[model samples]
Target chain A: MSSLVALLHATRIELLRTLRDGSTLLMMGFPVLLYPAMIWGLTQAGLYIDEARDRETLVLGVADGVDTEGLGDDKVQIVPATLETLDAGDVDALLAGAGDGLELHYRAGSPRSRRTRRVVEDRIEARNTERVDAAAVEKGADAALLAPLEVDVDAIDDATPLVQFLIGLFACAFVPMSIIVSTYSPVVELFVAERERGSIETTLCAPIPRSRIVYARVLAAALLGSLAALGNLGALWITVLHGAVLVVEDPVSLPFPGPVVLGTILALVLSAALLVAVLMSVALSAARTHREGQTLANFVLLPLIVPSMAGMLAVISESSRDVLFVPIAHTGTLLYAAIRHELVATDLFVAVGLDLALAALVLGGWMATLGPTSLIEGIQRPAWLARLAGES
Target chain B: MIEVDALVKVYPGHPPVRAVDGVSFEARRGEVFGLLGANGAGKTTTLRMLVTLLSPDGGTARVNGHDVRTAPEAVRGSVGYLSVTTGLYERLTPREMLVSFGRMQQIADPVGRAEQLIARFGIGAFADQRCGRLSTGMKQKVSIARALVHDPPVLILDEPTVGLDVLVAQTFLEFVETAREEGRAVLYSTHIMSEVERLCDRVAIIHEGRIVAATSVAALVAEHGTVEKGFVATVNGA
Candidate 1:
């Protein structure tokens, strides 16, 4: 119970200290507001787009011999194809065909210009198919022979862009971005900066066990990580809801199938915890001073990013159980799968289980090194650290 | 009360160092005992062991009747360790700093106790200001207040006034006297012979981790004519 209180006090003090720092404040608060503000800006841009779409009509110009039989609706008008006619407001758009290709020219204000071109292409395609069928019948052949194998796109998983968070195929960058942005500064500031300023001695002098102090640092870092993930998630949510991500699909339900998104965010939080352990262990082992700790934290970024790239590669192919054992990368695949609503109970368990186990191992290593004299021992550096500092 | 018996500290190195070799001392309630030593004389190491910051290689140290090695948490609760370099958290106000130490020490009504220390130390004028923004004397006062936030019975001070101006150092001397009058066992370590003469009821001059002389200040003055002369004699292996 006393350890718990000490942990709380340590965490509270850490946050307050970091709050007074301008850079830490920017890191903690920036992402949260940045996403929502970006969404708002994008929403405003989208409003202008929607308003333009409502106000303008798609004018399609056709060249000679192209049928006007079944082109499109009242919003779409098929006009004569000519440079003068197109340029003179005789037509707002022009559709022309080469051997097997078609080009459409339209005023930039028309949002449905592509739809208009597709409509005209469909009419021409149907006419061509009828002509081919007629020629096939004359040759005493079946129309099906014209195209024996048909290609079909089956979207088995139809999770919207908002749901996927653009993370499914590209979980590498997103996952690491969330983890690094959240965990790095807090861990370094709490461990390294405090050590440098000599304020950590007061904390060391407290009657609390060394393990409790480490626990407090881990908790503070995890809190920062969680807040950052929430910010990124909020930004993504707003971007998805406004048709900014997938412009065609309307956002009828947000946090769609709430459990999947929640599960994914929870996975990120777990990843943050895992990252805390890794970072703490690395910083403690590699850093003799605060500047060294900061420099060493940069090395952590590569491992986080590299493994995630591998995980996404595996996820792109079929996800394997072997990939589930790779720490940060596995978490990326898990979070990606969760965002897709394709996560099973085993997926969640393996990812979380491996992460928790990894954290326990790293933390155990840290605990073993901890002693009554650990802080002093660390600060009392050898001649090499001085040489290293001087060289740096 | 504080008791250290045959404490041993061997710092393993290229050539192993016996930083504190078989040092022993005791201080009862209402007494100011001074540890006089030159640089690298194990005064800090001995104090660190007594405060449970370092584990003694042999022998035993007890603070307020609790063995330091076996019962370090109780020792930490009963003793407040201070050094000249013991810095305050620049980011925290004095009140915040004191209350945090209070809570960690398991002091009940930590907020109330912190308030009491704030007033007693005359920190009300800048209690809410960051320690980094305060003057050197202000930061030292806050550091002292933090050490006492738990109201420890034993205070181990290692050169607590090394870099202070005359006034701040004099103020610390007065604080040491007050601590002694209040029945606290104050074990102070310093090279200042004047401090030894003015503050210590008894003085133990340490050289190369062993106590060369341990006796009352008056007795030392009788032998060498002055405390400074006696400190010089003890340090020169006389």
Candidate 2:
């Protein structure tokens, strides 16, 4: 009971000290503002590019043997010129007859030239459809017979299912990344900063067991990291919803995730936060300063990012049960499955259980190393060096 | 009260180096026992063993009647330790640092104890200011207060006044004097000759991680003309 009290007080103190630093506040609040601003900037840039494409009048030069009777639009102007003139930049693209078929040519390097090629290709396609329909009607046949196959897909509520799936895929990678980033500074403050400022000795001398102190630090870091993750996800969700509305037609709405999917994501993100906190504590155990610890903490990103990136890129099959048992990667795969409405109870149970067990094992191993040699001998050589010297 | 018997610490190297070689001593209540040595004489190592911060490779140490190896938690609970290496949480105010450590030590009324310590240590002027923004003297005062938060019966201070200005150092000496007056066993470690002459009731001259002499300050002065001369003579194997 006394140990529990000590743990609680230590956790509270760790949080109080960490939250008092202005840099902690800045790191926690940065994701909230950054996600929304990034989404807005990207959306604006895309809109500007599309508007510029629509407003430009692209000149298409017609070769001498090409038919130019019916291809012109508000954005494309047809003019008679030789191929040499097109090469000289007098026109954005060229249209010529090649072996009974019409060929279009444009400079690959210029954005305007590429845009003109697309415009002219679309116009030519429309003219071919018109000619085919006219010939069919003249032969007393149905024009619709030219194309017979069709597929009918319904939108989930006001948003298409594909849009919802894409959003889910994006969140699968982003939420875990935010959680890992948020835990970095706090873990450094708790482990490295405490050692740097020399308070760790006082803490080690406290009557509480060493494991209890470590547990408290990890708990505080996990709680703070989870809170930051929530802030980032909320801001990201809002931005994605607004972006979806703008990109889609009128009356379109993003489909809100159901309770099960939301719950799975929350559980996975929280577990990831705890796991990250434990990994960081162990990684920074021998670090003597905050800067050194932060650099070391960056190595934790490898295990987290590699598997998640693999899941995102489909480099690893998410449907494989083996992937569901891998740490960090499992969270991403399960999150993708959950969002796609393919998550199963067995997968979640296995993934979360594996992650929590790994965290517990790592914490226990770290706690075993928290003896006087590591705690009081901070001035002496680090433990690894001591071990290399054949000293314990 | 603190009792140590043949405490040993060996660091492995090309051949083993004995940092503390079978050292023995006893410090009773209402007296300041000084362990005088130059740097690397294992003064800090001996004090750490007494406070249960480091385990002895051989022999035993007991603080407030609790053995360091067997009952380390009880030993830790009974001693208040201060050292040059001990640091305050810079982001925390003095009062918060005190109260937080008190609570971690499982004190029944941490806030009340913190309030009493603040008043007793004259920390009221900047009790709420962060330790990082405070001057060196102010931070030392807060550190002293933090060490005494649990009010243990034994105080183990290892070179606690290494960086203080003269006035602050004087104030710290007075605090140690007060601790002795209050019947606490004070184990003070330093190499400063004046501090040893003024504050120590009995001084131990440790050289090469072994005690060369343990006697009263007055007796040492009676024999060698001055504590500094006595320290040099004892250290030089004369």
Candidate 3:
């Protein structure tokens, strides 16, 4: 048989074996199911907190003789009290010793707070202006002269909603990162498990080339990683659609254009490729048992997590262009930019192209290291392996 | 049809261990050639080189007129190798594993070939059962079937019955005889003196990564008074 035909046969067998293993099925399914549920719950919590804070009453402590008559009495309730009375916990029994006065805390660094504060200050200034205008009219002066030139700032383009931005960012970043962690077991199993069971020895000794064997294993891992990413993407899509309906009065539209969806898929493929390359390299270099390979592969989780954490921080800042070149970090940035229709063609191409190049380099090194002598003899410790000589 | 001329394998390290050093031997077609050595006697290393799995640091080796380093693909195409550690996929059935390997070898009608091999090896009863659930003997049988699935001209077995029970070992020895009758060049590596005495047409005793002696089993036994004494004297220089 031809070498190519032999490799194909081996690859098919590997794929079948991976599919049959229940552990691999769980590895693929767990991230898909769990991440979506977690994201939905988080979205719900965020929406609830926003709604509650938006409608909740703000208690205002009024200094004596300071009128607050037309400052929207419904939203901000005035509580008449002296500083001493508040400090001494004498305002109300329920509030006794509960700090000096009404806690005027707002959501820190929230856009909502900035807007609300501006409106409140504007209303106070308008009330002062009315008083000034009345006084000016009473003095027989022109009230029109009191009205200074006013400027209006109008938003020309529709702004992407904060919730949609966050959903897209998390879905792109967190889902893939989580999938990487979840699918790690099977990746290790593909090579490490075979080594542990002595099956790798059989494979190495076969009439197939060592390079072909390594290729087959890497291909299987990459395919599995892609499947896992797809499953997670599907779950996130479903959850986002349902959660959007529940939270928004108007149908909350995802800003995901055709480019966004395609970019996300491409980003996922690149990430999966990188992950497979790194994992296969580690697996090939492993000199001990399958358990050792598994232990080493867990280090991959650190790289995956870095992007997710960075994405969470990026959601607050909207966009940080510098992060676009940081491996998986770029994936999150690209997905966010794509969803908002803000991605430049050059940036998108660079991110995808660089990621593919990195994967290729890693895979190249792994292939070079996978000659038959190393793969077969590499697994056994030389001291112990040399003892095989002693036994002979 | 296998030839080895002063092959050497040097591993670079603190001490720079020599795994296979100055190993030389030849095996003719249709012969059950035994390679007897203690553990780590470079038996597996030699076999790996012949199968084109490893590169020899020095000298030359050929299998069926194909140089291991230059024509590895051709060498692989013509050689069947079975190591002591059976590498069968646990999730696959015996039939599935065989067919997969047969296809890998680019055999025509791999499934049909796998079925015939299964029947010949008397493994038809559990052909459909997953290999993970098979007994040691059964797994070994599946492995042997996979090795022969491509029906190559050369066969190399590295301690094929190292861990098998007496009955299973006997069955394996019988299979070796069958392989020889089919006119294939066979190289069987083992440390077990009894297996060598029972199955080998001619034997090369290897020690410290080199072949110390080579002769027919009966001639060595007669010359040394017994096969065990001959092997000890050959290995230890007694």
Model 2: per-residue Cα lDDT over A100-210, one tens digit each: 222222211122222333433354334433543354345444444433111112223546565556556676666667778788778888877887788877887787776
Ordered by lDDT, highest first, the candidates read 2, 1, 3
i-RMS for every candidate (Å) is: 1.6, 1.4, 2.4
Measured by lDDT, the strongest candidate is 2
The best candidate in terms of TM-score: 2
lDDT of 2 at B128: 98
Tell me which of candidates 1 and 2 scores higher on DockQ.
Answer: 2
**Model 1 chain A weakest lDDT span, ten residues long:** A147-156
All candidates: DockQ: 0.55, 0.61, 0.45
How would the candidate models be sorted by DockQ, starting from the highest?
A: 2, 1, 3
Off by over 4 Å in 2: A24-29, A50-54, A57-157, A160-163, A251-263, A314-322, A339-342, A369-392
Per-residue C-alpha lDDT of model 2 across residues B71-164, encoded as one tens digit per residue:
9889888888999888888889999999888887778899999999999989999999999999989998998898889898999999999999
Query: Which digits, one per residue and each the tens of the lDDT, describe model 1 over residues A225-266?
Result: 666666665555555555333343234354554865686657
Off by over 4 Å in 1: A1-6, A28-172, A243-246, A249-253, A256-264, A318-322, A369-392
Model 1 TM-score relative to the real fold: 0.80
Q: Could you tell me which residue pairs clash in candidate 1?
A: none
